[model samples]
Every structure is written in structure tokens, then in C-alpha cells.
Target: SSDVVAGYLDAKWNWSTLVGKVNSSTWKAHSVLSTTDATKNNLVGVFYNPTTTTKGNKVFLLAGSLGELNRSGVQRKRENLGLKLVVGDVREPTGSEPSGRIDWAEPTSPLNESTKTAHQGNLTEFLAAGGSGVLTEDGTLVFPLMAENGNGDVYSMMIYSTDNGSNWALSEYMTFAKCYNPRITEWEGSLLMIVDCENGQRVYESRDKGRTWTEAFGKLLGVWAKPRLVFWDVSLHLD
Candidate 1:
């Protein structure tokens, strides 16, 4: 609540972000939130919704780490559009952590060490930031999934929940064999998933909104470490 840099874009694409805050307790004013604190999770997206009661108006804070699903206490208000919101904060009521911040101006999205360990299994304990999440035009919140077995074998799978974060199930094994940390983007009416391994950078394309994926190989499909995908200005780019 105290450290937030918020911005808004009007109909003209003119934008502005908050640069200062007044500390209520001491009434001391300070500059904007530190850049180091905000970009830790490695992703920031405006989970767009075009088919909801809100007429697809922006949903608050749908852009955090992948453990977002396990944050039980944070309230998600996008069930009307099948997107879940997750928030993390210090559990101690008297602790220094800011109140479970829900600033539309600046959403609180932290990848946390959760206390509710029942549903998380080992997934919560490890590096849970699998990939950038996507909200489909059909209103499904799909996360690039990484599933690990008791035998310590890790497999890539896709997970989605139509009812926000209330229920989730594996969509399918990724189109490639033995890959993890899949980055996905939607372009030209297709879902493009990219990942890299010892073999090379593998490209997977899904035309049916993630139900099925096909291997789309390219010249640069190999000779790289793990790769990530991003979409901007009607183009899909790899990073």
C-alpha cells in the first residue's frame, strides 16, 4: 500500500503514473515505488477480457507469479470472465507488510512462501514462475504448466480453469517431449508456445485455443537455452 507507482491511459493512449505518496502514519511524502521491487517476477500483462458482464473492462492485478493460484486469502473478482487474481502479504496482522494491497492504481502481486500447504504440494516450494499466463478470448485463464512426479521427473503440461481459480485441471502434455518453462502468446488467431532445451528452441502452435498444439519448427529452433515468448503490436517475439 505504501510503495506503489500507478498509471492510467485515457482513450487517446495518453498515460501518466503516480510519482509520490503521503505516508499516513508520519505524514511524510516520498517518491514513487522502487523499480527493483516491481519487476522481480519477470512478467507484467493486462489480462484482457472482452466477454464479461463488465463488458471486458480491465480486471485488477491478473499479472503476477504463477504461484498466484495458491494464494488462498487474496480475493479474485473476475469470476464473471474466468480469470483469477492472487495476492500475497505478510500473515501477521501487526507486521510491517502493507495491508493486503488491492490498489487498482497499483496491484499487490507477490510470489510468496505460503502457509496453506495442503493444496500446493511440492509445486509451491520450488521455483513456481513457469511462464507468462494468458487469458483467452473464450475466457479461460491458462498457465504454462510444469508438473513434477514423486520420482522427481518433471514434465510440461498446460493447466486452465474456466471458473477462475476455483478449479484447475491439466490441459495436456505440451506438444514437445521433455520441456519446461513454456512461454505462450496469441497471434493471428493462433496460440504460439515457445520453449528451448538441449535440442533447441521448440515452437508449438495451437489453433483451437490450447486444446491441441502442433510443433512449428524454425531455423532457430535449436542452439539456445530456454526461451520465452511475448506478443506486442500484433507480432509474436521471442526472448
Candidate 2:
């Protein structure tokens, strides 16, 4: 297994990250990703919470970053956040690298101009839902995401890639406003999403990659109930 960590950097006004391999007893971590890298020059270096998922020998890392724009002599950040995908190839332990290593390729922005136009500019402040992503049985890479609209209302959705990592797209469907912090996974042939709503935690399942979502009544315990003074949110996953 492998692990990743992200921390804020005061100097760069952004964040830095480290990746490591989890052995049975020890975790050998390596300093691989940094916001200061020239590859992220166009951005403001504010790479936020990162989520990861593995497929075959490839590891995909997704993070949210603010756009950088120069206004006269001052640099300003964009109102809406953008998502970036960084891919790495896992390597076995070698002579110089005893703990093995991941060679991370340059970051790519999946939400390109065409993608934004396709969405009709309805989503703003779109960011990755921190935690782990899911790989479906059909080999689709799915990651949970939270987005805000013009009214500043937040909702949960998904971003997915069908042709491996060659291309990516955002889900057409989304949870109701104010329902955020989504935890998603694939069960059987459906994608299940557990989100904390205004009333309480609710379960939603989508059969068609995220074109639509339906509330899954009685699918998970402790869901669809009224919130209490002290209660823990339920998360869904398949062993």
C-alpha cells in the first residue's frame, strides 16, 4: 500500500506534499510533489487537499488549485477553483532506491476550456473531496467532488475518466444544495455516494457513471435519519 500527506507552506503561499509506500511495519516516505515546481507556475501554488486512487501500476493524484492572473502589477487569484491530475508510475525497490519510488509526471488540468463550456459555467469553487477515490469494475476512475454555485451553495458530484487517464469529465448530476463532503465508492455495478445533508447523512447510488443519482433508502444503516446533538457520519465502502 501507499500513502500521501499534504501540508501548508508559508513561504510559497501554497502547499507541499509527500508520498510514501506502506510496508508491513514501516512507512518509507519520499518528498516528491511540491507546489514550487515550475510545472505549476501558471497557478497560484495553492494546491489544496489531494485524493488518490490506483489502477494497475499507475497512481492518480487529484488536487484543487486556484488560478493565477496578473492584473496590472498585482497578481490575483481566480474566483473559481480548478482541478489538477498528477499521474505516477510505481516502481519496485531498486539498488539506490531501497523503498521503491513513484515517478510523477507533470500535472494536467482536466477542467479545460471545453469542459467548462460544456458545463455552462454553473459550477464554481469545484474541488476534490479529500480521501480516496474509487476504481469501478469496468476500469473507470471515479473521484468525489464538491462544487459551489453562484449563490455559494455547495453540492456534491463526481469527476470520472473512462479512457484511463487520457480524458476526464465531471458528472452531470449533483446532490441537492448544502449537501457536501461526499464519500464515494463502487459497489456491485453501481457507484454509491454517502453525503452529509442538512437533515442527516444520506446514501445515493448511480448506475450510469453519474448521469443520474437516486436516494438509496435503507441501503446503509444510520442514514436518512434526523441529526442529533452528537452523531458520527456514516461512510460506505465495499470490502
Candidate 3:
């Protein structure tokens, strides 16, 4: 069953964490996120996206939930989007526990009121891009995020933490409307993001910690060469 690390039902609409033991080739499942909490049930937890990344000996797990919250058995209409993050500490295996262990801290709502306030009320929802985030050489943790502008336009941006996950801040700049699913990485002290926009796929570069992003047209030479020739913008230099 190694091929099948884990599986769940679509009807449940709940997302959980499942870890595999490297030593034994075994798997363990944990329900770190729940949709049935009456206290917070107001926000329906589709738990749509789940992402993970590692920094030193710590592992970070992030997930996003959305939908209307139900209170008093009544489904209230509102934007109940949220992002949750959990940190885990690594420990060596012992005689009692051969597979080692990860001590996970309680999940925190990273995308809270502060996040909305920081965005200046431009975005109505935020979701984690489902995949691994990038850890820069300078030790900054960056994660790609998709957001909806209340007007139904989706934009790709980033949420990053410089102090080793102590606090995270949303990117002040975002891609043009209708761009999403940003994939980010560190290149020469700058963050590069590959995103799919309404017209086509484009690359962007951010040097100021996501504060600003500009089109990276020079990086992919081969891809841009043909387009430039079609427009006759530059002298073609054959390599």
C-alpha cells in the first residue's frame, strides 16, 4: 500500500494530514483540520488546499478553508475564507517509536482580520497554492497564494515570513487580475514566480520581498525569441 499513502472521500469535503514513516514504510493519518466544530462551524471548512515545507528541523503545514458559516443550524451568507498553519518539530526515533515523531503545534489562523486589514479590503478570499513553498537562501519562508478581489477577479501573490515563521505578511503587490496558481522559487537573491494569466503564462521577478513584481521577459530567451522576431522588435542573434 505504499503507492496509496492515503485517500479520502470527496463528499466529506474535509482535509487532513497523513505522514509516512520512512523506516517502516508505514503511514499515519491525523485529522489536524476539522469542519465539525460548533464554535467555528460558522465557516464551512472545505479545506481546499494543503501545502508543506521545511526549514531546518521544523516543518510547516498550511491549509485554506472557505464557504458560508453555519450558526444556530442556519447557513449564514458571508465570505468565510481562512488560512491555517501548523508547525512541527522533528525528533529522532527511539526504541518505543521507531519511525521518529513530529510534534505539531496547534494550528493558527494566519489569514485573519489582520491579513484582510493589511490588504486594505481589496481581497475577499485567500487560498494557499497546493504544493511545497520555497525557503530562500537568506532563510525567508515564502508561500504562493491565490486571492479573490471581491469583484470576482483572481490574483496571484505571496505570503512570506522573514523571522522564521514567527509572523507572516501578505504581499503588497499582486499579479494582474485573472492570474493564479503561482509557483515561486529563489534565484540569485530574488524571488521568481511563474504564473498562468488570462492571456498566457508569464514569469515575474520580485526583489523587495514581494512588495513589487515586474515581468521577467529576459529570463526565458528561447521562448521570447520567436515572439520578438514576429514583431521584428530586435535583431535576431543566433546562438
lDDT of the candidates, in the order given: 0.42, 0.72, 0.70
Candidate 1 wrong stretches, greater than 4 Å: 1-127, 175-177, 218-237
Error of 3 at 67 (Å): 4.5
How would you order the candidates by TM-score, starting with the best?
A: 2, 3, 1
TM-score of 1: 0.45
The model with the greatest TM-score is: 2
**Residues 1-239, candidate 3, lDDT per residue (tens digit)?**
01101221122233342222222344455565555421254454456567777898887877776556556666576554578787878777789864556777777877667667768538888877876688988888888889887798888888889899998889898988887778777888889887777665678899998888888878564223122324443443211
Model 2 bad stretches (over 4 Å): 1-28, 37-44, 67-81, 222-225, 228-239
Q: What is the lDDT of candidate 1?
A: 0.42
My TM-score estimates for the predictions, one after another, are 0.45, 0.75, 0.73
Clashes of 3: 1
Q: Is candidate 1 or candidate 2 better by lDDT?
A: 2
The total number of steric clashes, by the backbone 3 Å criterion, in model 1 comes to 2
Per-residue lDDT of candidate 2, residues 1-239 (tens digit):
11234321122222222222222244434444454541243554456667888899788999876545535577575533477788988778788754446778877777776775577438756877777899999999999999888888888899999998898888998898998778888877899988888887778899998898888876465455346586644452221
Candidate 2 at 220: error in angstroms? 1.1
Error of 1 at 23 (Å): 16
Q: What global local distance difference test value does model 3 have?
A: 0.70
lDDT of 1 by residue, 135-217 (tens): 77767666664545445555554555566544555544444435666676676677777765446567778877566777775
